[model samples]
Target chain A: MIVHSASIEAINKDIHPGMVVADATATLPALKVYNYKEGVCEKLLAELADWAFRFTPVIAVEAPDRLLMDISGCPHLWGGEEQYLADVVAKLKQRGYHANAAIADTIGAAWAAVCYGRPGQIIPPGGQQTALSSWPPAALRLSPLILDRMHRLGFYKIGSFINMPGTVLRRRFGQQLLTRIGQALGTMPEQLTSVLPAVIFQERLPCLEPIRTRTGIDIALKTLLEALSKRLLKESKGLRKAIFKGYRLDGNIQQIDIGTNRPVRNVAHLLQLFSQKIETIRPALGIELFILEAPVVEDLSAQQESLWTALGDSDANTELSNLLDRIAGKVGSAAIRRYLPAEHYWPERSMKISHSISEKPDTLWRVDRPRPICLLEQPEKIEVTVPVPDYPPMLFIYKGLIHKVKKQTGLNVLNANGGWISKRRSGITTALKTNRVRGIGYSGRVNMTKETLNGIYMDFLHDSYEAV
Target chain B: MGQATEIQENVVERLRQEILAMQGLRVPLENELRDTGLGIINNAFPNQTFPVAATHEFISDNAQNGAASSGFMAALLRILMCKGSCLWVSTRCRIFPPALKAFGISPDQMIFIDARTSKDALWIIEEGLKCQTLAAVVGEVQELGFTESRRLQLAVETSRVTGLIHRYGSLPTNVTCVSRWRITPVASIGEPTIPGVGFPGWNVELLKIRNGKPGRWQVAWNPDGFKVVQQPKVIEHLPARKTG
Candidate 1:
């Protein structure tokens, strides 16, 4: 096994990584070693990142051993950059880790200062060039092959070619060397993705007095909503769902939430929606805190309101949403339904209920087929008496009234692959047309005096083509 | 003697205008008049025009009537929606949304709000009426007192939205509405041997109306439009087809 990593004492003995374990053992017979486990470096870096959150909200973890933090506005809290850098490195060392930190304007410059320059160095802003000039070409974060080539060319230090003409350096060392120098010198932009996944839109309001009355609760809710909506509007986002919670003095938490059919940021409309549920929130014994959180937000394009459609249409659209929001606030939002056509033969599955106003049907509603105006939630079992086979029931009784089968229609059974086919799949057609049709899906359109029952299904237990 | 009769007729016309104005009804000019496509039924409404901005109550006393009233109102809403959105509020929405397509109204445009109680349904309906954006609001309620309906009427006055209250299985209350109607199921006329449920027909009865005739008519509704099943008094009601 090779030495993956070695302590400073082993390094002093010239035992470096990639050296055979036996050679390292010979150099120091008392050398210690441990088995290498996968992903240990990454786990340690993540824990360090979690600790780094106390310093700055904007921080990223570059895998293996680098913690990049933008401390442009963060160091002042610890008095100055020197103390901040010292405290950071000192605190990490106190955690039984040998940590070095460097503060600079650019990520590359700071990385170079931390890795190659003196420990706990603080390079002045915009002075990355002078600070990095003393370091070696390895400080520029170049590949090992390029560093070896530079070493062979007798350009060990970066200052050896600091003032070299751009074309000359480009021809000799290639474009990668120039790009690394450019990145360190802040000539090109680099991105730092934050540790936090997404921004949380939340607002808190602590009441000066414990609000006991409904009016007081309403005021608190409105105040929090206004502040939250302002932040949402500035970001060009709207919340589809939001929660309002009140922390009571008695340690009881009362919470109410509102959901919009679509994303909304309008304060007045949101207030109106919340007003409907204010009565349900019992501020029992008084409440001390109120919080509004919007967990589900979506980009509400501001241009879409003005760029397309006529002026009256967009206005009416918002007004309609506002109106629906109020209704949803009063009744549960589930009660509100809008249906789109679905391409299915079973009546219950024929339509899809949509919640949003902007949803459009993918399939056109079939007008050729007749549907009932009022559909029964469940089909009532009717008593039918048949005298012979292959004929419709002679008479049927429903709801205490007997319906005489003067004119009878054919029975239709729908298969998923095949469209409506005849009832030839039923072996008992001679005995009873609806012998075992109970609780199965079949389309049997009944023509009665006033109402029609449609979308009935019949499956045969004894026939070979049961599905058909 | 002829001058005296003209003076009396002018006085009657002035009084009619005053009453309509007090009720917050807008008098449409000749070009602004909208045809409800109800054929002669408009003859039974004030100013010979179906009040699109007013509340119309439909009383259904039986199961069939409940279904028929919804079907009949769906036809009216199709014409009155003016390509705008609609709201249907109820305790439990029984009107099959797909069935609205049969009446030429797209089901997607109709939002059904299910309330836990009839009181809540009416409240939602009143709030819906106050919004000027909606073209129509249909509330399925079992009962509504006179005071509650007046609030609904007041809501529509500020916003020119048509409100249809389909109250099922309840005694009719004295509501200060523009009109009251009872739509009963009429056995659909079809070929007996064809074995089909046939076309939907309603025996539409105008039980009450102010400043107009109260009449009943048999009307059959289809996607194309309404066909007056039995045209009433062709010779006597000739003026209605023109004025309405």
Candidate 2:
């Protein structure tokens, strides 16, 4: 293809001149020369489809960098037909590529003209050969092997190749050579398939006057949300998350992105979520135009009605979640936490913070086992003066106060695995051992057995404890 | 032995059934007491109607005995139970459970949370009022600022949950609360004609109510529980003789 050859020349400076480069051009026959087989013709076709919409919708990509446009009516707007072609070439050059443009009635004629015709030649409806007479045989985009064979057959150029016997050409270079010759002459009607354009969803809100204050920005955000919500509804879609871009006249842009727990179109709910997050958007020299674009959207499908669904009663879960959101917004989120049940029945380790979303599965609260309503933040170390082993201590010293045990209750059971380990006592076994060592006497070790952990009691001997 | 186990199981089953049967029996007793003005309507609110929107405050001195704190809660709860449920976020276990039950507040209707310190207690009470389900929220806390009290007042105005703040110990005089009620325990009477002998009696004084007259009233909280009675209008009274 001419694009391959043109791109090769364009990238020659960057490529080492003497390197033995494999001509991947054959592997991707229609790929641009500079692309070096990295991109397929299909992907290039899509890119061209998106880019060439500026010129005309009737454009279709011919193999390689070639584009065929039925610009039968839409050319004079960009100055004139010749100027428009020049404008397209200039734009392509600006996008880091050199391109050649030509216009013709049939796609084959246009392809041949751009690849082989003289510079700035507009081939008439029926003039294909006369238009391509002076072009080289390689301009037909035929295999180099076939072109070399044509040269050997005394056909140095396409004009001379056309005069050669058609049977001789097919017999020598196979049928593909004769087809390419016919295609260049506009006799074969070479098909140029078009690609569908990608769907793009975007909504823009231009502020009537430049918004600078917090109130002004909030008002503008409401307007942007309304426009975006309407567009999403019309498209039968809802956004999972949206990006609010504040484009300032000074060229700096600030983007504030907010995500919702569920698909939502309710303006008030969305406003409340964003009101907590809009502070993250640094106004940045004040915004003039606001654009809300949703990159993540899905079809709005109805949930299957369930026979067991509660219809009239209000959903308590939603009310709880909204209450949590409000509390988290006012007081820091760290201050609010919902109690979650743990597998083990230990009092201290039985609860953890639940996630903000309500969809997460939770463990059921168990009522049979008695859990202490008040858990001492730290299990204070007590010095037992009573005889150890099987008996509960009659008196123990805690915080320097000797409290006598009024009652001795024991819950005897085997120590289970995965029990609650309080954070303060990281090495619990060692801490328990240390308590035994520091206890009343050397005989205290006998009382520190795991079997004796059922219950220990103490009462205050005196009100002698002072603030530490 | 097997028959004894079966009998015990039957007894447990019968008790559960009895409890269920008695759930609706309180309506008549409450009505009769309401007619006599001796139930929660009389004991808690002598004003005849329930204290709905306005804030009721109790400021305690914690003097001679810790009566002001406990008595204020007992009286306040009695009034709150007249309307329905009352929420008590207890800082210290300063609330006497038996006293509140004597005032006709079923233990089930009153929810109690024993927090470690006074600060944690107010936080729970504040959070409870925001729920708007409680008829009255009572907290026995040491201190509450003007701004914090205003926040509670505002939440109560919107939710209609009566805010009853009972200060635990004595606070400085300048400290402002919505309304203040001081409670003190006097000697108990033996009988209708007899002098004084039995359990501790409570002297309920409405030191402050937003739109109502503040006055001291005599009430005997004997072993038979609290009973409102007429007493001579005097600032100080003679100590009743102890009867053996």
Candidate 3:
């Protein structure tokens, strides 16, 4: 058995990581051991990275217990670089974690400083050379083979290579050693990638006391909405969708989402939309944090009030949109629909509902022909007696009602060759020939069977029939 | 004294005769009707114009008749929806959106609501009527109670938006609507010289009209507008019928 890691006490007893467990057991017969679970360390590192986000938005997690933070402009918020570094390390230590942190001018330098320098070290800007001069070359995070080769060459300290010419080092150790040295000394640039948060218009509030009451949630929501709306107003933008999330003390997250038909920046209106569903969030064990996120935002121009208070140029449109928003909030977004005409001859295909009301129909409605006021979704089959070929039915029975042929006109035969005809045998032809033939006349081929004719008739019956 | 009283009575009688003649002249002005653009049907209404800010109900007995009524409503809406949007509440809307274009109403100007039930549709209609932003509210309902319609009328009275209710398979009962029209599709006027179908025609019956005469007119929708067609004196039978 090999020791994967060692605690401070174990290390104090001269036990170290990667040492043979049997040998350590021989050295200290009563050593306690634990079985390591796979992926637990990485999971903890990820979690630590998430927690570290509270300090700075820019942070990257290095695998196997290492984190890099670009505390460039963040330290001043904590009163200075020294206090900020000390505070982070102290907080982590209080949480029972043995942490080592170092601040430097560069990522490579900071990484080396944290592993080799003092536990809590702050290397001033442009001081990477002096700070890392005494550290071992292994602190540069070089490969084990390179470290062994350097050790054999009697170049133990980074200062030994700091004076070596770049070309010579490149010839002896290749590009990696030169790159590492250059990066540590701040000569070469390195990219530090941080985790990108999904929501940019998100605000979080950590309560001093756990909030469990409905009023508390409402207050938090109002505060968050005010802050968010202020930010939105400054950006000349508005949010259409908002999600309110509550982090309970027990670690469960409860969330509710509200959507608006139009971009909204009014704090009161947004609060009202959320107020309807805010009670649904159950704060079991009390909520510790409130997060409000605007996932969908759009540009919103400031509304100019009408001076006369009468119907102004845009007042009617604005009022209509506001009313629609209110109704949508109550019934749902799908309840409201706006339709536009399509360039199709078929009734159902003739008009299409638009996603938004602002879209205008490209084509005007064709008024050259008379259309039925109501078109059946499907044509109903009817029994008809045609007095003569190519003439409208004299009598028809539809839904068990018999009607004598009335004065008939406007008869147009719909040929089967029309490409727009539905493939489904909906019996529209027969139904139209019998019931709707008087106004907008239709006749099916006499050679077709009753079954196929029924199908075709049904199809036509379902089609939008023009009223004569 | 008797002679003086007789002279006074003769002067009073002359003044009364003059006033009655002036009233007779004013009758033509008061009886002037508002032309509904459709010249054939203007004489049926009191002022010869469709009632504005009033509720009108259109009943259809069958699907074909329902289609005809829908067309009539669309035609009316084209004139009513001048600048504002309209709300259409229905359980199942069968009127083809493109068909509205035939009546000059754009599909984009209409906002449709698919209510889950007839009751919900009525509620939505009432709410829509209460909103002044909408120019009109159209509901295709199977049932509309007298009280429900009265409430709707009150809403429209305040908002001034026209309410057009297209009720299918509904029982004909007395309601407080300004007008109740039943439209049935009839034979369209045929163009014998052009060898094709003419404009759509409807047998429009004003079943119940408030302060208006109830009459039936054979009206055809033309590109220009609705035209009152004279009854054909002779019936012609053709051997071949053109199918659309």
lDDT on C-alpha atoms for all candidate structures: 0.76, 0.54, 0.71
lDDT of 1 by residue, A1-468 (tens): 998888776788899999999998888899898988999989999999999888888889998889999776888999999888888888888898877889888988999999898888888879999998889999998988888889999997898887898899889888988888888889977778888756899999998899999888888888888898789878989899989999999999999889887788777778878877788888878999999999999998777434333466777888788778777777767788889989876666778988688888999887764556765555555555556654455565555455554433334445543366455664334235543334334322222222323211111211100000
Q: For candidate 1, give the DockQ.
A: 0.37
Give candidate 2 misplaced runs (Cα > 4 Å): A1-203, A206-209, A231-245, A249-264, A276-284, A291-312, A315-320, A332-334, A356-364, A368-370, A412-468, B1-42, B45-143, B162-244
lDDT of 1: 0.76
Candidate achieving the largest lDDT:
1
Better of 1 and 3 by TM-score: 1
Error of 1 at A155 (Å): 43
**Candidate 1 chain B superposition, TM-score:** 0.88
When 2 and 3 are scored with TM-score, the better candidate is 3
Q: What is the interface RMSD of each candidate, in Å?
A: 6.0, 14.7, 7.4
Q: Across residues A1-468, which tens digit of lDDT does each residue of candidate 2 receive?
A: 233333454355443333334544443445343434755866776687679888886667655556776676777888777888888888988987667888776666677777677665678777877766677777777788887777777776667667779998778789887787677676676665545443455678787677778898788888878887777677767676778889887888988766543355545656776787788777766788888877787775433111113432123333333444443444334443334445554333444445444323256444332112122223445565435443344455555755554333232221224343442433433333343314221112111100111222111111011100
Can you write out model 3's per-residue Cα lDDT over A126-210, one digit (the tens) per residue?
9998988899988887898888888999998888888888899988877889889889888999988886544489889999999
Would you estimate the TM-scores of all the predictions?
A: 0.67, 0.42, 0.55
Model 3 residue B218 lDDT? Answer: 76
Give the per-residue lDDT digits (tens) of candidate 2, residues B53-170.
4355676564323343454455445645565456566555433232344444544445455555666666666666665445577776777776667666666656666677767465
Q: On DockQ, who's better, 1 or 3? A: 1
**Total backbone collisions for each predicted model:** 6, 4, 39
Q: Candidate 1: TM-score?
A: 0.67
lDDT of 1 by residue, B147-212 (tens): 998899899877878999988899987887777888877655566765644566778888766556
Tens digit of lDDT per residue, candidate 3, span B1-244? Answer: 9999999999986775565333221112232223346664655544456665668899987666776777777767776787478988888876556556666777778898877788878878887888787878899999888899888888877776779998989787656677788887665565656533345667778776654556777777776677778642221232232210
